[model samples]
Target: MFNNVYPREKYLKKIRPFYDSDIIKVITGIRRCGKSFILKAIMNELIDRGIPKTQIIYIPLDRRGYKNIKTSEELETKIESMLGDDENYYLFIDEVQNVFGFESVIHAYAEEGYSIFLTGSNSYLLSDEISTKLTGRYLNFETFTLDFSEYLEMKRFFKKKIDQDIYVEFEEYILNGGFPKTIEFDDIQARQTYTRGIISEIFEKDVKTRKRISNVPVYERVQSFLLNNYSAPFSLSNLLECLEKEGYKTKATTVRGYIEDLKKAKIIYECNRFDLKSKKSLRREQKYYLSDLAIYFAMNTDNRLSYGPSLENMVYLYLASQDYQISIGKIGKLECDFITRNTSGDYAYIQVTYTMQGEDIKATERIKEREYRPFRKIRDGYPRYIVSLDRFRDQQEGVHHINAIDLFLGKEKI
Candidate 1:
């Protein structure tokens, strides 16, 4: 499947640290976002490292043969039949959710000297079942769509030079998003058509089946409303009122439940506002970002990404990629796009804007001003940054100003 494809060497480099570790390699992400390709990439690496074909057992449970074979016992039997008496073997499974209680089988394999790697499209595959069964025995890697730099590498057209044309190409990427299939096909109309088709598939698989939603009509309307609203604070009453105006009768609890289930499923992610003073997480006011921009593009007929919200969503993706716990930061009325805490017990503030120009200039300045005051009140020295599309080599904010493109390239400033 990876034939002639530019190898995702960057992700491979990130996964290298976990190689040969006792933990199972768990690759997870949104559907059609290329989790399976990463698995194949790992297999290619093992082959290059001289691992014999006989020593590797690869199973894709999405197939019909494994659809009904849901128990751990059945998995063990299948493995035993495939590689009899092989003490040291590499086990690779894709879409393991088709097989119920498969995590126990994975744990059993890991116990017996078999190196296991698993990939799944839905978060439930690893939610509680695998987490409890393989606690302390898994390393997670999430695969998102191609970033701008990565998109350039994927296309041979921009091999030697990177300039203004590349920036123009990036704008198109922003509108269409970086889904591999969309990128593979350059036509805008075709890309939009493909996105719409995939949205229907996700509705069928993730929202309907995964969420077990009976009122498909209401669920679809709520999803469309959320997509259109992107990164705003949506109060429950406001949402319910809007639905009622649309002539859909539904309870607030049902709408809220569907929203949260979709979030846990990684279809949509909700960001709660972070209070610097009092230092507490607040749930009443929060923002939501979709797992993929393609979801918005498909559902919203306008197919336009609001500049500020889109930039915030981009920062959200960046923070998530770094394995940070993310939330929106609110100091009084001033807001920061993301507040993230690393594993080292330190936190940082991120402000994302499409362009810090015009009347928005003062508002952007106020965010940094508020950021400094709160820390002084608490006397905690966490870093602050403003990410924008502006070209400011040296901005006079106490907070570092970072370019959005550079942020995606992993050159975030403190």
Candidate 2:
């Protein structure tokens, strides 16, 4: 059904390191984030390397053909029947969590020396049961929707170019998001419809059915609240109060459960507040960003309301996908949008704003005091940045002010 192939080299680079290893490769992400396509790409790579098709066992439990394999035993029996004696095999299972007792089957296959690769749509795929069964035997690769570079690749695939000005494309990207399937549609309505359908499938299969939540309307209200207030700090009590104001009488614990369910399904990401001065994690008033900005656009139907938060969410997702450990920064009364720690123990303090170019001195000073001063308060030597839409350069006092588009396009390094 796809017209062009979008080379997801970032994920492929991650998978290449462990190719043919005994450890199980587990790929987890939100629904329709191209997990199945990644598997197909990997299988094609294996075939190109002279691996026989007969030796590679691929099963997609979500498909109708595999609907009969409801139990772990049935899955194992079918897989085992395809294997031959005394030979290496590659097993690719998509949405493997559909079968109960799947961990046992994975363990059995691992014991037989088969190189196993699997994908699932929820975090529950790596819950305690699976972890305990496959302890020290698996590696997880968390996938996300397309990054800006990948989105650009998709645009190029359709023979569209934005060489002179990219703000036009970036604006559309900020609205439609980077879901692989949604990138093909030139029509705004079609893109929104596609993303709405993805949210519905996630709600139905991943949240409602998986969590056994019968009150879907209540659950949806909680989702709407989160999407509307994306990048804002709110607690369980705050969510409870909002729901109460909406005439939905739900307890704080129920709201917390719903939030957790959305997080597990990868529909939204939660960022905790970290006290920069005290070097501790704050418990209350956490921020949540949606898995894709298109979700908020699909639900709200107005991009203007979510414009600023959408930019912040985009920065958060980009940093996260690059393997940064991110948290909201709070230094006493002041707040910084993101505090990211890289793998090498390097830290970066980032503040994202829509624009910092207005001719109003009061507005610019407000941004500096609120967003820039917090970075100055830190005594530690680390890179600090203020990412916004302004093209002007304001690199002073050890703080770098960069355009958000340049950051997303890899023209500027963090």
Best candidate according to lDDT: 2
- Per-residue C-alpha lDDT of model 2 across residues 214-314, encoded as one tens digit per residue: 56778889888898888888778777777778788767777788988999999999999999878999978999998989898888756674557888998
Q: Model 1 lDDT vs. the true structure? A: 0.73
- Model 2, runs deviating above 4 Å: 1-4, 158-164
Instruction: Name the TM-score of candidate 1.
Output: 0.88
Q: Assess the local accuracy of residue 411 in candidate 1 as a C-alpha lDDT between 0 and 100.
A: 63
Candidate 2 overall lDDT versus native: 0.85
lDDT value, residue 257 of candidate 1 = 80
Per-candidate TM-score against the hidden true structure: 0.88, 0.95
Q: Quantify all predictions' global Cα lDDT against the true fold.
A: 0.73, 0.85
lDDT per residue as tens, model 1, 103-137: 77888778876888888876777775678777888
> Which 10-residue window in model 1 sums to the lowest lDDT?
370-379
* Residue 49 C-alpha lDDT in model 1: 85
